[model samples]
Target: MSRLLDEEGLPPGMLAPLDEDPGPARRLSRQKSAALVQAAVLAALDAPSPPPRSRRRHEWLMGGALLVVGAAAVATWHLSRRSDSLAPVETPVVAVPAVVEPVRPEPVVPAVDSERAEVAGVMRTGAEAGGDVERAEVAGVGVMRTGAEVGVARAEPDVAGVGMKQTTTGGTEVGVPRTTPDVAVPSPSAKLRGTEMLPSAPAPEDLLRRANGHRATGQWKAAEALYLRVIRTDPQAMSAYVARVASGSLRLEHLGDARGALRQYQEAQRGWPGGVLEEEASHGVTEALRALGDRDGEARALESFLARHPDSPHGVAARTRLREISGR
Candidate 1:
């Protein structure tokens, strides 16, 4: 093959046998090429390999998880901020001062007239006695004196006076009995019959009128007594209602007895509920509560009064008092 190659103009060493020893320079070149190829192979083995499809999928999932965590944190922060903004704000409390009312002076009652009261008392007694007593009126001083007594012995008594003498003393007659068979003692049935003929008690209307007269004259005790009599006589009468209300007013204003006045007013209200004078009684209840220093009760009473009597004459005052009690 070598002889053939030489004939074809090929190099002589190119056709050397495979078993023949190469020269040092050729061997060195061959060694260098082998070393370069090994180095390339080692570099290829040492370099990092690309991840597999499954590993790449896991990495993507981790990245997505990280992104989701960041988004969740951001969303939590936004939601917390929104909640803080939407939270209710506390309001500061302010104290209000109480309203005070001015004090007023008490009313003064007029002095009682003695002579007029005396004459009134005498006339009242004579009228109540049912025409049994004789009253003599002195002209200038207006004084009254009792002239005679009823159911007394007379001079010509006991069957036309069998020897009876009439004795007169100080322009008055005195009866004396002598020891005689014709003079007879009076029995107890005769006295009882005489007592039975007297008149009954006065009417409630008359008693109320008399009480009003006494109250006007400043005879407070007498007026109160007569009013009580009227009330006791006829509790359901209109005159009794008037008497109770008047007595309440008298006790509250003139007598300065608030408790007594309250009783009278309450009794009138109970006796005559929803009557013509109900508004007056309700108003009086408020006044009584006010006088007793019961602020809450007074407020309630005033409210009730306004509700019941919206167009009452005292509506303005009732509203004013209610506002005062409520500290408005």
Candidate 2:
């Protein structure tokens, strides 16, 4: 009865029939749900909450990392600076050694042409003899000579090539007295048999006079040769400078030989370096090179002339030529 009252005590019709009392299964399900709830509550209460994140500790960690990065960057900068300090410095100036030139010895002068002077004197006498110089014997200096003794004979061409006429017979080649027969001329040594019997050496003045006379007489070849002879015999002679310049002029003006003119001027320079005619010689060299189509040679010659004779008479001309060559 007690069990009935405890559980099934309530009859369906008893007290308005307690609505369908749950069966044992239903009771068991309720007990199980309550136990699950109790367990969930216990678990919720027992689990330790995650420790609150420490803001100070986070800041410390971030600061440490930043410090390490900063240290690495500073060390890199310091190493770069050290490397730069250890590097070699560049200098603006590069030093080069100076060069020394070798010294050259002075040139020796050439010997004088005494023999040429003697021959010129003889030729002068022959010209004076009206081309009637037959043969001559050399006596002592200032001594007398025979009238028949001649060195050379003067002949005039005959009409229609008939026969030649000698000048010794008073302007007539026909038979005349004092006209000597043509014969083998005596050797120069034979003529000078007597000790220095040849007339006194002709002065430089005399040679220059004869040369001038030849030039005036339209004897261009003879005049040029005579002038050259005077120069060769004695470059230091009073008129040698004039003779050299004149010779070069004749070659250029009359002979049309620029090369020959060039040589004449060069000889003057060689005979008398830094002399009065050096400027002229330099000018001549330039002109000759130009004639030969050697532009480089002409330029060099002009430059050398200017360097040596800056104040020379030809200086202006030389400078002009240099400008032309250099396209200034």
Estimated TM-score per prediction? 0.39, 0.37
lDDT of 2 at 278: 61
Candidate 1, overall lDDT? 0.51
Those runs of model 2 whose alpha carbons end farther than 4 Å from true positions after fitting are 1-197, 214-219, 235-241
- Collision count of model 2: 7
Residue 322: error of model 1 in Å? 1.1
lDDT of 1 by residue, 1-328 (tens): 4335344643323343443233222322222333444444443455333544555566556556655665665555555557657763531212111111111111111112343355456544443333211211111222221111111221211111123121110100001111221223222233234332224555444455555556546787787777666565545667567667777766666677666777777777877898666777777778777777888988998999899987565787889989988987
Q: Indicate the worst ten consecutive residues by lDDT in candidate 2.
A: 166-175
Clash pairs (backbone) in predicted model 2: 4-9, 131-154, 133-150, 133-151, 133-152, 134-150, 135-150
lDDT accuracy of residue 309 in candidate 1: 87
Scored by lDDT, model 2 comes in at 0.49
Off by over 4 Å in 1: 1-198
Tens digits of per-residue lDDT for model 2 on 96-166? 11110111111111111243344445444433332211211121112222222323321111111123111
Count of backbone clashes, every candidate in sequence: 0, 7
